[model samples]
Target: MRAIGTIWMVARREVKARFLTKANLVSLGLLLLAVVAGVVVMDYFQNRDTDEPTFTIALAEQTAELRPGLEAAAAGQDTTLDISTMGAAEAEEAVTEDLDAYISGDPAQPEVLVADEVDGQLLGLVTGVAQAHAMGSEVAALGGDPGAVSEAVAQAAPDVRSLAEEDPSGGMFGPAYFVAILSTSVLLFALISTGALIAMGVVEEKTSRVVEILLATIRPASLLAGKILGIGIVGLIQVVLLGGAAIGTMAATDLLADFEIDLTTAMLMIVLWFFLGFAIFALLFGGFAALVSRQEDIGSVTTPLTFLLFVPYYVAMFMVPNNPDTTLTAVLSQIPIFSPFMMPMRSAFDAVSTGELVLSVVLALATIPLLVWVASTVYQRGVLHTGGRMKLSEAFARR
Candidate 1:
């Protein structure tokens, strides 16, 4: 009870010292604005009218039988066709911007009248449709049903299989991939920034000999816990606000109408991984910072740990999106340290099994206690050592 009370007091002090400051407030506001601006930009690009060519084709009564085939072929090639029924003479007269081409005369050998040079796609569709129409006529003349023969030809397409598996996130260009990229980016930024803050705070306290004063009253482990908790709370607030703003912007704009993504589950996973990842990195930063009394030397001890954080970050960014189901990604995601960065992305793509998720969670949770022991031991031994920088080996060794 006493330790808990002391820790709470320390945490409250940290929150007041850090979160309630004017600088922090202004920075938070700027970050929110940036998120909202980025979302709006993405929405603009995503929902804007496309510049793909649309062919305005007019069909006369004589060539009306080519409508279905022409329309289907145009659609298959991703071309838009504005088809309308009209007389051949009227279509030829109205061939300014309103009409591109008009098909007249016989259905089998259609007279395709164009305003100028013919569009390759438009011409190909017309030629193919006429040929198919002629073939169907031949089939009808041979006492075979034209519709049944067409259906048989359509069903005769051979099945194709690829050796490379299709990407679940739709080839790294989909909305789900964007969400995963954003989530991992947030995780990396939050973890690295918070971890750096924790280290700097520890070094700042040591430089002013404030840790000694705080240590006289509270246990070192409790003090460390409180500081991490306080800074973590501030970080979580930033993440939640930014994430919510982006999500709200996307929803309002209907930017992801074509793709299905569960914002709730994605947000939940980010928070979960962040908490676990923070625990691991925060403890290390706090422990390492204790080894140095001067702020100048703080980076020497924490630099290696920063690199460690980036290893998982780069892997999550480059590898996971491309090959979420690969053996390397699967194995790394299940590991305790890497899970914080890897699992959320894997889960987002619906690539992770329940067993894998359970195992990853268990491993990460199990590792925290071990880290707590190691970090507290290092901090306990190193916090009081002043002047010269203490070696990590000396911190772990009992006096």
Candidate 2:
């Protein structure tokens, strides 16, 4: 009870001191605003090329059969396209009037008439429709079922299926991938920012000898835990706010209408992995920063840990996108350092089994006690012995 109370007391103090400051609150607000701006920017790029579509494509008599193919081609593209079949003269008349283009052919050549030289999307649609019809005709002449071939292609092109062994997030491709990317990015940002706060706070106290006085009243482990706990809570709040703002912006602008992005699932992943990633890096950060009293030396303390962190981070951000089922991903998923970063993505894609998740958490937890012991020892020895940067070997040796 006494130790818990002391830890809570320190945690409460840290939280208040950090967040109650005018500067910190302002900065936090700015970060949330930046998230909104980023979401808006993403939205703009996503829907930019699509204009207010009201297009009429006149089809000559022979080309009338290409309507089904044209409709299929335009299925998921969400365009308002009108296809009207008429005589060649009427089609040409329609083009000179209000129609955007005309697709015509049969014993002549597949052609699209437009005011401009070429419009890629429109031309492609006309070509695809005419080609599909030609293919169907050729198959019929060859005594094959054109209907069967079309039934297969029509079943494919625009729809989705989930035959992959491990599904992430139990959602579709677009949503699952979006959530995975966001989760990795947010988890990385939150852990680094909060861990640095812990490191900087430790250096500040040590430089002023404030820690020396606090040590008489509390154990080093308790103090470190409290600071970590405090700053971690604040960091989590920031993540939630930033995420909520981004989501809100997307919803308001309807930028995500086409995507199935499961924000809820991703947020849950963030909460679960954030603590694990933060703990591993934060303990090491606090322990290492104690070796240097000067604030300028902070970078040296954090750089090594950052490099170690960045390895798994890069894997999650870059490599995972390319191939999640590779042996390397499987191997890294078992490691505690990498699991916190990697497992969430697997879960997001529903590629992870329950057993895998449980095992990864257990492995991550198993390492915590050992690292906590090592980190606390380093903190105890090096916090009081700072002149220049204390070598990590010296800290281990002295401890």
Candidate 3:
């Protein structure tokens, strides 16, 4: 009960303090503006250019007879092929100018001439049309029915198959990757920024000798817990607000309607990881801050931990493309220290297994109490020591 009261007090103080600050307001405003701008940019690009393929073909002598077949083939492939008769010189010039858009040759056995190498889709389309025309000509030469040969060729084309049992939630990797990267970036930046603020708050109070006065009334653990809890709640709030903005924007724009976000699962994971991550890092930062009486010493003590944070970030990056199934990824995903970032990222791609995710969450929860105990011990030992700076080894030993 005492612990609960202390946590509530700290949370209230931190929330009020932060909300009243001009810097915090400015940061929030900028964050909102950036989110809006990002949504607009994404929408603009998504709706911008059309995807329909347009082909301009320059046919050589005798190819005009194949125009009907070529047009039919182009229509089948959802492409617009503009067939024009040209002399060799004119065809060569057009091919040299835009190889991708121009295919040169007789309507029958038309050879594609391009300024450069053609794309596979265009090449395939052109090849299929040429094959159909060739088959028709061969039948005519053999004194067989060309119409029957054409019908047989059309019936022989293979059916396109969809690989997945269910349609993919998102259209493709583009939007999935976008959401994953954007959400991770926002969450990571928010956590690190707010965690640093919590550290600063602790240091400020201690440096001003305000902690000494407060300690006379509150238990050290309560004070520490309160500060961490309060700031953590605020951090969670920001995360929720930002996530809501992103999801709402996506929903409104129909950006990821095909791809289900599993909002409940995502929110649960975000909330869980935010608290666990905040507790672990914020507590460590608070303890580290206490080791230094002056602000200058704060950075030196925290530098090592700061560098450690980047390891999980980079590990998550490498794992994104690896589909979260690699040996290294599996191990890292289960590790509490890396789970928050790693699991969420892998989850975004539907790469994580249910067992792996549950196991990771369990491990992270199990480790939190141990980390909190260690951090609190360090805080208790170093908070009152107005020394130059405390070594990590010494801080632990004294605690």
Residue-level lDDT tens digits of model 1 in 120-147: 8788889888988999999999998998
Candidate models: Cα lDDT each: 0.85, 0.80, 0.74
Question: In candidate 1, which residue ranges exceed 4 Å CA deviation?
Answer: 36-53, 57-80, 83-120, 130-177, 246-261, 318-331
- What is the model-wide C-alpha lDDT for candidate 2? 0.80
Instruction: Summarize candidate 3's per-residue lDDT along 262-302 as a digit string, tens digits.
Output: 75566666777777777667777777777778876667756
Error of 2 at 214 (Å): 2.1
Q: Which is better, 1 or 3, measured by TM-score?
A: 1
**Which tens-of-lDDT digit does each residue in 281-340 have in candidate 2?**
888988888899899999998888878888898887676656677888877887989987
Backbone clash tally for model 2?
11
Best by lDDT: 1
State TM-scores per candidate.
0.76, 0.74, 0.75
